[model samples]
Target: MKKSLLIGATALALTLASPFSQAHRVWIKPSTTSVSGDSEWITFDVAVANGIFHPDHFAYPAERLSVVSPSGNPVDIQNQQKLRYRSVFDVELTESGTYKVFNASQSLVAFWKDEDGERHFWPGRGKTGTVEEFYQAVPQDADDLNVMETANRLETYVTLGAPTADNNKLTGKGLELKALTHPNDAYTGEPIDFQFFMSGDKAQGTKVIVVKDGEKYRDTAGGVEVTADKEGKISLQFDEPGMYWLEAEYEDDKAKAPAKKRRASYVLVFEVLPL
Candidate 1:
């Protein structure tokens, strides 16, 4: 689907009274993270839902998704479709290494009160605007102006044969995950270490949350929360083998003019196999 159309659909979903439309989480799940053979295909489901891995809220924009092959080249996606609650796509893993599937975006948002005490939003709410546009349109003397820059990344990994580090290198922008343990090689009951970075620097004291799939079916939330140490690293272990969602957020005063604060968030869906 086109980017404009997807934004309109998302706005429509948010207009509804349902709770699912409020504060939903974005995730991309792969059919399998690790596969063997000369060539293979991996199907992915992208959604913004209340529950992890559940497509109950709305379909995430398929146009925003991208794939990077192990050779550090852009890979093409196939059969992209936006369904009622989720977006689906296929990736042909012809390369014998890991492929990174992700949806990453950064935008500037602002709210200000005019001299007449009327509130206004830059580019309007639920819409994305560039930093240059924000400075050009917003009034310099605007009252109570609150400007923020947000960077969000939702990603997963699929390894064709042997896992490769080429696809996991940090881009030195926004919030990112650096895996001390390869995502595709994680096993149940084993501690897997991951680190968080904000604008290429180690994001110390960041809070990371992990939620296993099937959250709605369980009585208790059973979610795990860990804090990144001084080194911006956290270790996680899962008792059961299943798909898990990991999310982290960091806020800082590194934003440029017109934006006082910058918020960065990341989400990763990874699979753990039975040991």
Candidate 2:
């Protein structure tokens, strides 16, 4: 979907009430984030006032939310907020760019699982949303007046996290979520569709486990195992969608240097929305 379209939809979701739309509230999972150095722009969080707006209407709920820029240009996102479970966004923040959050609509989102004993993306589980950016432009000085040059220069961004007035905050560092995906949204009597990404450490073979909606079911049979590619990317698909908690535990012993050692972990929350 187009960024403008997503922005419009986001506006309507928070500003109005409708049968098709769910209520939401704004809160930041991580109160703050950092960047490398002076760049262009930065990205962080802005609190919303909605209850909790999840694409499924219940699970993975993130209330009415939308992002806008200083130029009055509504920003585009991962096209997945509606499908918070299976979507991700690269929020930009730098000198070249500007970051200001509108607000959130509702409450803390919770995770859910499907019936096939698989875990999916969970909301309100305290996940780390990526804020990528650097500074892009220099502020104008009264002594040096150059409007044309300023307009011509491109906006830049850098990574950073800020807080909204609401004070609803979620923050930490490193990868917050373990690799996991939803097997099904509702329930699945047949094969389900599952997919996820993991970032912990380098172990021989990673074990994927799932906890069904508050239930304990271990499908370690042909056990859902995953292997990293050359670029450290792994994905799996399920036949259905359900509330589940996907986790991975690995250790990197080959690292003799501090930089090579593993320290942080991350889990991506997202679900497949009806396209």
Candidate 3:
């Protein structure tokens, strides 16, 4: 998927070597600027290498956090508590765009204790690393800032559209499964609904089929035309559930002559977990 990948870079003035006489500065890790799509997890690791909490510290520190839009409006944020660390909020981007994640102290740093038994003070609130998604507008989640001459690091973006009320949708060039339901994940009894729909701009005659655990059926998805309204739709049952693979077939455009032209199909892996 050729989703726009906006590259942005941020710099910090607080040096790692400096000593904190007081709650010094806030920092984010993996300073690599570009985050990998899969390996992309942001962690707000606080510095506790020194400064133990003293009794005289002010009320527990406030780590007020929120996502700041490109235009500078504060979006609604939600609190998140994960096993590793508790985050004040998370901003999820659905459409690709530019945005910024803003974080600050709710109050001056002090002392605190999380679900974990460890009682912390000073930069105590720093350990809460999990930030739940707030706004979701992607490929729009941009820190979109700079122009890089050459970016050695690349984030592979996957076009995963949310399942519509009908359950299935296609990303034109690829298969998208958001609202599919599998009643028989084990493939034991009567088949159930694993419905979905898709379409493309190119008028490529494509075919979609449902294949069972180990069997094959010719009754492929019948009316998946590349036309405007009559795009591809999947609404069928399976004999039994185990792991049914939805295979899409199209005349292989990449196949050269002389050599037997192979059919090109995209296999959307699906499963029906037993209830």
- By TM-score rank, best first, the candidates go 1, 2, 3
lDDT of candidate 3 over 157-272, digit per residue (tens): 11112211221223443222323342212234444433222223332344544444333233442322221113334455444434443434333334222212222223333443
RMSD of each: 4.4, 21.5, 22.5
- Leading candidate by TM-score: 1
lDDT of 2 by residue, 1-275 (tens): 69566555544333221111223322222112333344423222322222211222222232333555434456654333433332233455442323333222211111224455332221112222111110112122222221110000001112233212111112222122222322112234432332222232223333333332212233332234554443343565545443322333332433222113332222212222221
Per-model TM values vs. the true structure:
0.88, 0.25, 0.25
Measured with C-alpha atoms, the lDDT of residue 104 in candidate 3 is 22
lDDT of 3 at 236: 54
Candidate 2: residue 126 lDDT (0-100)? 28
Better of 1 and 3 by TM-score: 1
Error (Å) of candidate 1 at residue 164 is 1.0
Question: Which lDDT value does model 1 have at 174?
Answer: 79
Candidate 1: give the clashing pairs.
none
TM-score of 3: 0.25
